[model samples]
Target: MTTLLEGKAIRKIFKTGTVETEVLKGIDFQILEGEFIIILGQSGSGKTTLLNILGGMTQATEGELHYQGQPLHKASDAELTLYRRKEVGFIFQHYNLMPNLTAYENVKLAADIAEHPLEVEKVLTDVGLEDLKDHFPSQLSGGQQQRIAIARAIVKNPALLLCDEPTGALDIQTGIQVLMALKQLNQNYHMTILIITHNSEIAKMADRVLFLKDGIIDHITVNEHPLAPEELTW
Candidate 1:
């Protein structure tokens, strides 16, 4: 497996007045192409912050980051924007779809911005939302809306998919359905995916699991045989 992303000694800090809070402290890791990775941590543990940095939405305060040998840590805002638009896809816990737009329209909006995008209809079908493509977000169930959001992200044909607490807003069954969809995307598209969630059970479906404690990775574990979403509990 080839390395798709790498981070070394990464750090992030926020300052308000004289008070400074360090959120990330010297984090390091590598993500392989076509691999599914899980970052597990409680709220305020900096999991989402790390995911933001990895996706180029935010810059690290210190250290180095590279994507396919390109220096992300040194990239300018314009460069980061291009990287995000061209190479990265993001899915958040909240489905940020436009309430007025239909599922197909939401996905198409993202596809239109990509340099090499997949067919919007095809991606919607991939996420099992083809029949609901004409429905507005409010008309759909939470899981259906989330699948639409996933379709929106995947339609861009991004090299990397970054998910922040993707299942955080759903019931157990609905979350499982979403996880299954994500797993299928990784297998069928051979997409490299990084997911951050406090649900430790979700780690069983990952090729590699990273445990974050107090803004640093406490340990890393690789699963020889990753489980399916249905097999996960919690």
Candidate 2:
């Protein structure tokens, strides 16, 4: 029941040609430790923006953000870099792997920057990618590349993992495989995982789901026993 991430009265704004746009309007929420919370929303719903703020990737125009009880806004850039490197892991829809580097090399690049990196081989095996280690991105399928991305994130053994449309680029079967790998990690490692996606089917796999619409949270749902990836429905 301990809070791992919290955003209080969060607000974000942008101005364009004398016009002001408010993206998040006084939204507030909290994520508990070891929880897999999925944020579901349609296009332009501010889900990604909210997540960016949570991960220190971007600052909120207003309000407060605390990660493990420390003020995010007060942290220096170096502190935030360390905060992100050691405490948080990120996965994007587009496999953010270095095309020039082999799968093994790309994962190690991230692990090298971490304060405490998990053994590269252990993480690769966990994601079922040990055999694909030396393959380059161009030599791998979309799914394989994504598995590499997951391995990269898990290699950090971070306190919080942020995934944005993790399976957006994969076919259903491949996406499920990826989710299974991620779900297994959540169950075994007890890492706090936050996934942002447009697919409502994906919410069934989360301990809690936050639904957003037009810069506001429309609803929040909690499932005591989340379904496995194979059991999810749209």
Candidate 3:
């Protein structure tokens, strides 16, 4: 099968007035369609930097990226924006939900912008937030809010889903619930999902685990039979 995501020799460096900080030295990896990939690393290990590059949310100082066989580096910013909008879904750690808007309205607003919006009801149902849709971010719990965020991301039915510490703010029980929802999306929708996390426990739920350090892939392991999210002993 053709690769759905590819990153070649990606490097990102931040310069702050005579100070140069190297985040990712060189990253090279490929993810096939329908694969669940978890990136495990320590804090400040460049995991999120690599994810940003792959998602086109940030530019790589050096190297290239390919999504669905299309060149990301060569694509213009506008083109990349469109690509991200229609082909990639991003779930951030902070939930990124609008505090003022109700859960349902927030999703509906995003759907209005996408070229092909997913069924609002279906996404709400998928995330188990049908009833909470009428609630505002301030009115819901962290886990419930995050579920709405996940619903918004998958609502467009993007080919790829990128999650960064998606369960960071929640407790164990709620975290598992979020992971279960994500796992269901990956399995049922066949969405190629890549998650960046410091939690090694979450690795078991993925089809493959990529251990990253200093922005380089230290090791990659493919699990012949990954455990179900509910079965994961986190």
Off by over 4 Å in 3: none
Residue 186 miss distance in model 2 (angstroms): 0.9
Selected candidate, larger TM-score, 1 vs 2: 1
Best by TM-score: 1
Quantify how close model 1 is to the true structure by its C-alpha RMSD in Å.
Answer: 0.8
Candidate 2 RMSD computed on C-alpha atoms after optimal superposition onto the true structure: 1.2
> How do all the candidates rank in terms of TM-score, highest first?
1, 2, 3
- Candidate 2's displacement at residue 218, Å, is 1.3
Q: State every prediction's TM-score relative to the real structure.
A: 0.98, 0.96, 0.95
Task: Please list the residue runs of candidate 1 whose C-alpha ends up more than 4 Å from where it truly belongs after superposition.
Answer: none
Clashing pairs in 1: none
Candidate 3 colliding pairs: none
- Overall lDDT per candidate, in order of appearance: 0.94, 0.90, 0.89
lDDT of 2 by residue, 94-183 (tens): 997899999999999988977788999989988898998999999999989999999998897898989999999899999999899899
In the range 48-130, model 3's lDDT, one tens digit per residue, is 88888888888888888888778898888898788888888999989888889999999998898888878998899988999
lDDT of 1 by residue, 41-137 (tens): 9999999899999999899999999999999999999999999999999999999999999999999999888889999988988899899899999
